[model samples]
Every structure is written in C-alpha cells, then in structure tokens.
Target: MKNESKELATLDYPGGKRRAKLRIVSDRVATATQGDCLRCARVAVRNLIIDGSRRTLGRVREASTSPGLVILGGNEGQAVRECAISDPCGFTAVHAREGAKLNYPESSPWGWSLANGVSIACHNSIVRDNVLTDCTDTGVVVYCSPGTKIEENHVTTKRRSAIGGILLVDAEPFSRDYSGIMVKGNVLDASGQAMRVGIGIGPSVLSDDMETIINDGSVIGNHLTGDYMGYGIATAGLQGWTIRDNLDDARYMGQPSDRCLDDPVNPPPQAFIYNSATLKESVVQDGFFDSDFAYRECVGLIVEVDVRVPGWWDAQHLENAHSS
Candidate 1:
C-alpha cells in the first residue's frame, strides 16, 4: 500500500481494534511514502499483527528537506506485535532523516537480522514505549539525532554476540552534532545473553577521526540488568553530557555482595571507557555499578570508572568492523 498523503492516511485493523483472529501476515506488508514531505508529516499505523515480512512491516521514506514523518503505532498502548520479521537490517518500522517520531507503544519487534530492532536515524524525534528482543544487533539506536527522546522502552538481548541493548552514537560518515538529546527511563536486560554493553555513547563501530559533540545532553534514570553483561554504561569523549542516577543489578562474580564504589584499583565493573577521548566538564555521579563479575571482560580490554577525568583512562582502539 502507498500513502502519498494527498490526505492523511491511516491503516488499521478491523474496527480499529487488534483481534487475535485478525492478521496482516504477508511477505510485504505496507510501505508509505510521502511524495511531498513538506505538506504532510504524519502516518498512523495501528492494531496490526504484521507477521513474517521479509521487509519492514511499515516503512516511511520521505524527503529530508520536507517537514518530517511521524509513524505512530497505535493509540494508548494498543500497538500490536511484529513478530518473525526480517530484513537486511531487521527493522520492524523504518523511517528516514530528521523530525520523525516512532511511537510503538507495547509493540514487540523480534527475529531480525544484522541491524537494530528499532532505529531512529533522524534528528528531532521521539521514540518511546517499544519492546525490542532477540534482534541480531542493537535494540534501540538513535543515530546522529539531536533533540530526540528515548524513553520508557524495554530492550533485552537473548541472542549471542548481540551488540548492546541501547546506544547513542555520533555514528560514522555523518558524525552530526547531538545536542538536547535525552535518554531516560529505559530498561535494558542482558541476563545470560553475554551482551556487549548495556548502554553506550561513543562513535559507531567504524568511526575514525570523527568526534560527536553532544551539548546539554543527559543519560539518566535508566536501568541496566544482567550478570553476563559487559559494561553497564560505556562512554567516551563527552562534553556537556550528564551521566547520573543509572544503576546496574548484577551479582559480584555470581555471588551476592554489598559493595559500593570499589577501590580505583578494583573499581565497579559496570561502567567503562571504550576508546581514547577527551571528556571535559561532564558529570558522572550518584550511580551504582555493582561489583566485579567473572564475565566482566566479555567485550575485551576496557577502562572501568572515572569517565569524568580527561585522559585519566583509555582502553581499546576502535577498528573498522562490518557496518552495524
């Protein structure tokens, strides 16, 4: 189906209700394109049980120069699940450029390949209340998008070699400025998944000589849970970014222990520095990063704690890996 948006378009289940008997199971479900991106900015997709699509369940590709595209799932937690979905990047809902709002409330996107389950590649957008699980790559990634909010979402890694749960990156090729962005109130779980990092702020896996400047940004009130996780929060080269009030719930080497702020020599193992970068005027305070776990080194060499000190610690240089 195509939505030119000469008029507002809404594709929904029968009677605008999600019934178990109703299904939109197809190899290609729906694709909405805005021929004139300036005139229109919203497409509502609701109550759809889109199953087994080789491509995305709902796709919107509009002109970046145009206003924006807002793909709303359903009203007030009525969004249904997109299961057994596949694509080159495994995205259940796809949009392009800036000013896009992806609100998939209570929607679960699973069984994807080689990419993020929910990707907000544009700036000036909002992504909230979606649950991502078992995706081959990251769960939710807001790439180069400033003024964006990633909130109240749940992400879990059940797939081995998954690349973290939630990530905010300047990314590669287009290391745009990410200012006024907020990542708050999200839950990331890596249980026995050997997940790489819980939440991270850095360059993409292939970024080189690229610096992502984030001004007035904040990562707060988020929870990272797991035992076999790598870094609860991994960051590098941040300025004007607030990293606080985030907690990790993992056992100390698989045994319960009451340890807070281990010695700098034996620092808390949940937070780390990924690469060499200057961190100036950023606040890292009032958080809990459990204790050392035997599987703490799951992602290889990393510097733990002291992310506020400039050049105090630096670990592992980024190499050009396959595009994620």
Candidate 2:
C-alpha cells in the first residue's frame, strides 16, 4: 500500500519457482505507487486487481502509456485490468493480442515488419472477471498461449484499432499450430468509441499466408453491444473453431442492425470471416460445421477469402523443395 508519495510497500517472491510454480493465496494487499506495476513470467496470480490509472507522483503522463500489467510467459494464472490506455509503440500499433515485433521474411510481400500489442505470453492461464475501459490496444490478449480461458470480462474501448478486445493470437518467428483456448461470456462495449470487433481469434497481424493456425478453440456465449461494431466477432486463418451461441446486442444498443449506411459497399455481418478461400478451397460452404448462430442480429457468419495474398507456408515449402 502507498500513501500520497514515498515508497510505501513492496512484495517480492522469495525465489521458490521460476515461472509461477508456487501458488500464493492471500486476502492481504500490496501496492506499487509508481512505475511498472507488475511483470509476471511463469508465476500464478489469482484474485488480483490492476488499475492502470495509477501513476508515479511526479512522472510525465506518458508513463501511463506503458503496459499496466504484462505476463511474458507462464503456464497458469489469472489477469484482469481496470483500464489500459497505450499509444502506438514499436510493432504493437496494430494491437494483435500480445505486443510483439513480427519480422517478415524477405520474400514476403506484406511488409518488412509490423508491431502488435503488449505481450502476455502464457498458456492454460485464466483471464477472467476483469473490467477494462478505454483501451486503445487490445483489452485482454494472449500470445501463442493455448488452453487459456478468457471469460466473464467486461471491456470498453473508446478508441478503435485493427483489432480490439479479447484476442488470442500467435506471434513467433516461425509458424505454429495451437488449440483449446476458450473465449466465453465476455461483454464487449463499444458504445462510446465504436470498435471493429469484440473478440478476435486466430493469427496475429500476419495471417495472410497462414503462418499460424488456431484449431479446436471455442468462442461461445459472448455478447457484443456497441455502436457500428463491424463484426461482433472476427476470425481469420483459423480452422475447427467452435463458434456458438454468440450474439450481437443490437437491441440493447438501440440499433436495428450492425451495418452502417455511410459505407458504400455493404459491410460484412456481425460475425465476419476473412481469407476463407486461402484457408481451403471449400472450407467455407453454406454453413460451417463447427459454427451455429441463428440470429438476424448476428447474421449467422460471413466468410470472405482474398485470393491475392499468397499462402505463406505453402509458397515457402515450394521454394524450399525447388532449392533442395
């Protein structure tokens, strides 16, 4: 705990576990009244509350732009945020889940590199029961962390980015496959700022060629309520994902539909799927096997596959074979 100023208190782990192995339970309280609240790597945190609104006494306001809470790599824990307002720093401008700089291969056409949100690289962790507001970046994000449960959280972002609120993605050097992350019962509010999507699943910012394929995860029972939310939920470069029972709370938001009249071309429905043609020739048929949403507000789901972007690994494999 901290008073007006002067270092009030400090809580340090006595070096028992490297990556959140020992579980510590307490109703007590600890506080850091200054810069960099908590950075957890392989540690377990439960029933903890982090408010990014707190800042050092005399520091510049820019200090708040830094990450309020960051969990680099761990196996188990729960992280919730009261508020996180950050600027476009490094490669995290796109805000694709965890903030990491992704460097593309020279042969790739997308670009040399791009940034994402702050990195919360953990697996099987529980990010639940938290409330975040006005986060320019992603509200709750996990990087290459599978089997994580993002549930029962309330996120309100006043600003808009390419991706916002409750995202699960992978941003490693090489391509990888992961599954079993569950996103359920989260309330995403964009009434103030209007977000692009409430919850985003699969691939960081670089899914054009399928660098990462998230499979068998579930996005269920999540509600999206806000103004002009392009898609309540959006998925790209993913397969075998169970998307069910999710709805767009347009009635609550006093909106008849999610599409906007200003946009010339009709925007996709509440649930949007991009790059389906690239994923598989017939992967997206009349209805997806693992998805079930029957609501006018939800518009079931829509898949738009851009054929221009070359399949990343598919091209790489062909080039490697020719070289060999």
Model 1, residue 249: distance off in Å is: 0.7
- The lowest-lDDT stretch of 10 consecutive residues in candidate 1 is 315-324
Model 2 error, position 3 (Å): 26
Q: Compute the lDDT of residue 232 as modeled in candidate 1.
A: 73
Give me the runs in candidate 1 sitting further than 4 Å from their true place: 1-40, 52-93, 99-113, 159-161, 171-175, 204-214, 251-269, 272-277, 286-324
- The list of candidate 2 runs beyond 4 A from truth reads 1-119, 158-162, 171-175, 204-212, 251-269, 278-324
Error of 2 at 200 (Å): 1.8
Q: Which whole-number lDDT from 0 to 100 does residue 314 have in model 1?
A: 14
Candidate 2, residue 47: lDDT: 19
List, residue by residue over 1-324, the lDDT tens digit for candidate 1. Answer: 133222222244333223222223433333322221443334333333333333333232222221111123211111122221223212433334344333332223333334455555555556666666644457667666666677876776543335667777654323556677788998887654555667877553223323455455788889878655656776655677888888777432222123312322233445444333445677776443422222222333222323334531111011111110
Task: Assess every candidate by TM-score.
Answer: 0.61, 0.51
Error at 194, model 2, angstroms: 2.2
Worst 10 residues of 2 by lDDT: 315-324
